[model samples]
Target: MSLDPINLAAFLGMALVTYLTRIAGLALVGRLDLSPRAQAAFDAIPPAVLIAVIAPSALATGWPERVAALVCGLAAMRLPLLGVVAVGVATVVALRMVA
Candidate 1:
């Protein structure tokens, strides 16, 4: 029994799905007029996705890391968004390396 090939296949499947989704979305969106409700939902998706991804990762860490991530997220809301991500990732990496 082996897991490496299964992991690789799983990763490739996800990558393929992600690529197809993006390509299909781009191909379809411009040609169709989305309903007003759908457009509103689409507008909401970016922030929803950002919060969904960041909230869990930021909250799942230890107290110190969570505090750091919270502060970084607040600071990120003020700076270019990438700064916040950089701060969070760098802090975690540094903590991991030193510990």
Candidate 2:
């Protein structure tokens, strides 16, 4: 299949923007001396971002998604991170098949 020039340009532009933002973030953080509270907040970023991305879809979807998210949360309490993810995915797939 042939690549469309416009789509290729758009993809490259997006990649460049993503790369620049990551580099800029690293540079900015490297230059900063954060207070303890600020450092703690920065550390919370990953989980906060994960929830921000997951919460909307989990809440908006039907029972399968909600139940899967709950399973993930419960698994997280007792299982490794990979296991938690596996449980979540399995629950969703099983529920989807049943429905």
Candidate 3:
């Protein structure tokens, strides 16, 4: 099987963009003199971005997925992180199988 040149180039371009953006962000942040509140906000960016990315799919799907997310959130309150994740995954798989 031969690799297509266009696809190869596009993949490389995406990699380059991702690499540069990450480096640029690190460098910019390193140089900044952020206040305590600003630093806290910056730390929250990752989880906030994660929710932004996942919320759409979690809400758009069927009831099973929504219920799984809710169960996972509740599990997170009492279980270890890995245990919560396991419960969430197990709940979703069980719900999907039943459906």
Candidate 4:
């Protein structure tokens, strides 16, 4: 296997752009005087994005994964992000064992 210089440079360029966007977003948001309603919507973005990424795969996979997703969703209501992820992974493994 060979390391292609073009691919490596492309990957690094994309990573820099992504990083800059996030930093710029933070800088821009820091100066905004957002109302409570807008702030609430902004705070919800991370979890919404997390669900958007994970929900499709979870719903389309086997029963164990679906069940785990449900359990994870429930846990998310009360737990932090790390805890929620742990619960999801553990639930899937346990359910798979029983299946």
Candidate 5:
């Protein structure tokens, strides 16, 4: 529960790697020609990766938090993304307060 040099270093390292990979891909993407089917699949990868990264953390936090996030995510899908996140955060805070 403390911010330390080691944690910061690790975070920076991961961020650097992520940034480089994304930048490299963006730079190289136009140089290659992907088939229509492959392009469609590639387009979906970002969301899939996001879900894979978020799902575990959301689930590990417990049912209440997960439910809040789902409702928020749905709302975000329908409304603004920021609004959905706010609603989900509010839900979690309210639940925690009541409990």
Candidate 6:
């Protein structure tokens, strides 16, 4: 199959813009001096975003997901990010099996 020239150019343009934006962010962040609290908040963004994305889907279904999300929310307090994720996955699996 032949590649369409316009599609290829559009893809390349998008890739270049994305790469430049990422590079600009890295440079900007490196130059900034943020407070400890701000740093912590920045670090927390990923997990917060992950939960925001996952929560709607989790809550949309039946009782299993609701219960699993509750367990995961508790686990997030004491556990690290990966551990919290593991707990959530395990809770969902076990609950799905039993229900």
| Whole-model lDDT per candidate | 0.78, 0.90, 0.86, 0.94, 0.80, 0.95
Model 3, 19: alpha-carbon shift in Å?
0.6
RMSD of each: 4.6, 2.8, 2.9, 1.5, 5.2, 2.2
Q: Which residue ranges in model 2 land beyond 4 Å of their true spot?
A: 74-87, 90-99
The estimated TM-scores of all candidates read: 0.54, 0.68, 0.70, 0.86, 0.54, 0.78
RMSD of 3: 2.9
Task: Give me the candidate number with maximum lDDT.
Answer: 6
lDDT tens per residue, model 1, 4-99:
988999999999999999999999999989899999898778757887877787688666577667777677678665676677777777776666
Question: Per-residue lDDT for 1-99 in model 2, tens only?
Answer: 999999999999999999999999999999999999999999878757776898899999999999999988888789866687788889999999998
What value does the lDDT take at residue 77 in candidate 6?
90
* Model 5: how far residue 28 lies from native, Å: 1.2
lDDT of 6 by residue, 27-94 (tens): 99999999999999999998989999999999999999999999999998999999999999999999
Q: What is the lDDT of residue 18 in candidate 1?
A: 100
- Model 5 error, position 57 (Å): 1.7
Model 6, position 18, has a per-residue lDDT of 100
In model 3, where do residues sit more than 4 Å from their true spots? 75-87, 97-99
Q: Return the top candidate by TM-score.
A: 4
Q: What is the C-alpha lDDT profile of model 3 across 18-69, one tens digit per residue?
A: 9999999989988899999999898777656755776688799998889988
Residue 64 of model 1, lDDT score: 55
Please give the ranking of all candidate structures by lDDT, highest first, separated by commas: 6, 4, 2, 3, 5, 1
Q: Candidate 4, residues 1-99: lDDT per residue as tens digits?
A: 999999999999999999999999999998999999999999899989999999999999899999999999899899998899999999999999999
Which regions of candidate 4 are displaced past 4 Å? Answer: none
Candidate 1: residue pairs that collide: none
Residue 66 Cα positional deviation in candidate 4, in Å, after optimal superposition: 1.1
Q: How many residue pairs clash in each candidate?
A: 0, 0, 0, 0, 0, 0
